[model samples]
Target: MLKASSDAEALRSFLMGYQNTSLTYQTYLKELERLVLWCAHVQKISISDITSDDITAYQQFLMLPEPKALWCGNKRSKRLKSGEVNPDWRPFASELSPTSIKKTMSILDSFFNYLVQTQYLKGNPLSVNKRRKKRTQPQTIERWLEKTEINTVLEALSEMTEPQADAFSIIRAKYIIHTLFYTGLRLSELTNHRMGDFTLIEGAWYLKVIGKGEKPRNIVVVDEYLDALTEFRKAIDCPGLPAFNEKMPLIPMQDKLNPIKQRRIDQILKWTFEAGARRYETLANQEIEEGPKHLRRASKLRKASAHWLRHSYGTYLVKSGCPIEKVKTLMGHSDISTTMIYVHIATNDLLDSAQGLSLQEED
Candidate 1:
């Protein structure tokens, strides 16, 4: 609470110890900021005094969303630029989805665990009960592209006419779309990429990424993806292979030398999805109109996001006889259970015994 600086210092020191990616730090900071604000304003207790009951209330706030007055302030000032202190910030914009709730809770769990390890707090209050609710259970099979959908998207990208005025942007979008599908990198990892992140090891191409939890991972890609990357770089007048020691942005901004932000990447993916969706609609015409309102009615590229391509990557790998554990390592999942979900993809080989072997006595 505002009454003392000791708890604040403890939290600050704890966050200072974090070596995770910037996005992770931002997310954790925001989550803890919400906790501190709630504790100070509503519970009238210090952070050190928070209980399971408080955590339960916080869960409710995440599910129902805080009142507009509580979390609907102006955007954080970029001029200030201090990660720890944001003068105008709101923790919640809307109700958290089940997945979101779990994500937030996971961050908080790590926070309290850190506090406990540092001997700053007695115990973690949010480790039990509320998070165990069925609402947060991960679905067995999440959304991913079918083989037909994948081909449709490729065809659409291939059909892009040359000599367009926005040639650079078009080619860049094609490369990014393919990379996302091939690498299965999270949006943050993709945006955080640098020119030095790529390497040619043993005549194979690999991309080094700082993924979640500040873990470094190497993603191996085939020659086609590497070829596309080289083509894009050469189009922009860069070296065929990115320099290992260079600090230049991997996916550079047109005007600035810096890398583009996640929002811009999201825009690119959205455009790609819509384009592919339109192509699929044309290829498989139906009665329904092809627009946002009726877009969900179609399968394939309908309502897909960049992450769907990632899921498709995992799904494709698992369906193609890759072991779940191997996929887990490649995908950079700390928990194999998270990777196991890919095992249940619709395309998994079905045993013949599952089909009826019954022979009728009198047909």
Candidate 2:
């Protein structure tokens, strides 16, 4: 059924379908490229020849990629430059976590299914189930900033200087942070959306976005977000509120003519996070009694990223009594199960509710 003799050729064909969406294309390319490399180099087998046992071995390999010197590279290492593959490039950055392994397996399953449907392969090896094991506890979401840490980051942003050279960048960073927190839009959604996507329906505003799987959804725009948008526009010398069908990028480049790339967005957030961490470190030194607490917050802020804001958004909403279904919609989660992780944030409230229960009879 397969026309492509090499796994590399098959991977190229499969990824071609996703070329229109850069984010998805990149993700698929990363996972599939690693798999092809592993099949050729480590397993000495073709992708079409992989079996259920081979998949099990692959899963174990992901847990701890063997011969780290040959399979792993530093996070900043480049895979390609000027259309040439770098010799230092490695498939694995570090050992994959259980969640990461699951995600990689899911992506591989989809890839194999696509191949099967297109007659490129016979069947998906990943679909063959092994003996069932006892179900383990669900992993809790941990990569989110607490409310106080978020406030510290906000304070750091507020203290940023608006020099003529960096005025637009500073304001844009502020808007990006607030939008991610309030709307929970994924990184790609934020970059792809245009100012025109913010529409007024009746009296309220909503930002329309094409989320994961090309699903369209409108996220409600709160007053604070609108205000941030206004500030961002003013910084860029556009209208205070976006005009109807305004074709400007939601987050523009320094030129104010092009949309900021995802890499730039990541860099901006990283800088902001580091700034917040530094600010906390300074506070820690100043406030002797609260030094330990401040130091801990500084450490967490140092580790925060753009996705952390998304998690923080969902968590804060669940904490604020927002219904799970509504949170799911706002988060663009296709499955309620994906949204259930935020429910863990309510453990304290759930415990508080139990305070009313008593073993002794009440009068």
Candidate 3:
């Protein structure tokens, strides 16, 4: 019943359906390409010919891709250039972690389901009952910045002098940091937003964003975020508040025409965090006795990324007595279980209560 004559043609047809969302399209393409290559070379079978046993073998293969010389390469090495495949490019950079293996299986499950739905496959090879019964491990969110650390980064951004960073750049960095912390938006959601997405409904402001899975949700805009927005707009020569249904990008580049890319956002956050780390390093040098403590703090800050701000937003909300349901809504999480992790993180102090209760704890 398969429509396509070749596996490559069928994959192209399947991928075409995801073209509307560039990120999803790229991710599916990458994962599927690896599967297709594995089938053609290793399994010596086409994608449609893959069976349940083959899927099980593929799962093992993902853990440690064999023939490392042919299947692994330097991370982010170019796979293609000027419309030609790069000979040195490999399917994987190295072995996948347990978490990564689970993710790959999930993607493959979805891919097989899609093919089944389209009649490209007689049945999904990943539909084994054991796989269906596998429970997803609870998500552990360990990466996030503390309130004081966030303030330190902001202070560092404020301290940048001319020739180091321009006035516009400093303001923009502050706005970006504040927005991420306050709104809890994913990187893609933030970059995809337009000025019109921020709307005043019944005398209150809200930002509408299309989150993961293309689901749209509205997030309340706090006063602090509004102030940051005002500063950023003023720096770009826009009104203090955006016009109704404004067509401008929420965060634009220096050109003020094109929306800022995710890479630029990463760079801005990295610079601010590194600047904050350098401040800690300076303090460590001045106070030799506290050097180790300060360096540890510096290391944490250096490891923080844009996603940390989002995690921080959720954690702070849960700590501040916001209802878990409300936090779930604000975060645009499809499942309340995902929001519950924040509660676990916020109440981690409870561990200290049990520490002192042991019968023979202190000798």
Estimate, for each residue in 1-363, the C-alpha lDDT of model 2 and write its tens digit.
Answer: 546777777877888889987777878888987888888888999888898888988999999988988998744435465767678777776788776788888889889998888788888887774343357797689889887887787788778875522766677777888889989988888888788999999999999988887788889999988898887788778889988988888888877779987768878887888888988999999999999999998888877778889999999899999999999998888889889999888689788988898789878
Worst 10 residues of 2 by lDDT: 74-83
Clashes of each: 0, 0, 0
| Per-prediction CA RMSD (Å) | 5.1, 3.9, 3.9
| Candidates, ranked, TM-score | 2, 3, 1
Count: clashes, candidate 2:
0
CA deviation > 4 Å runs, candidate 2? 19-23, 61-82, 86-97, 117-120, 129-134, 161-165, 350-363
Cα error, residue 80 of model 2, in Å, equals: 7.1
Pick the TM-score winner: 2
**True-structure Cα RMSD, model 2:** 3.9
What's the TM for model 3?
A: 0.82
By lDDT, the best candidate is: 3
Reference-based lDDT, residue 249, model 2: 88
Clashing residue pairs found in predicted model 2: none
lDDT per residue, candidate 1, 1-363, as tens digits? 222258888788777766445767777787888888878877899888988888888888777755666666433443355566565556664566666787888888888888887777778988665466555455676677766666666667667777532767877787787788778888778888787888878888788888888888888877877888888888878787788766777667874278887768877766666677787566445544555433442444556767778888898888878888879877889998889888776433365545655676756
Q: After superposition, how far is residue 181 of candidate 3 from its true place, in Å?
A: 1.0
Q: Which stretches of candidate 3 lie over 4 Å from their true place?
A: 21-23, 34-46, 49-101, 129-137, 351-363
- State, as a TM-score between 0 and 1, how close model 2 is to the true structure: 0.86
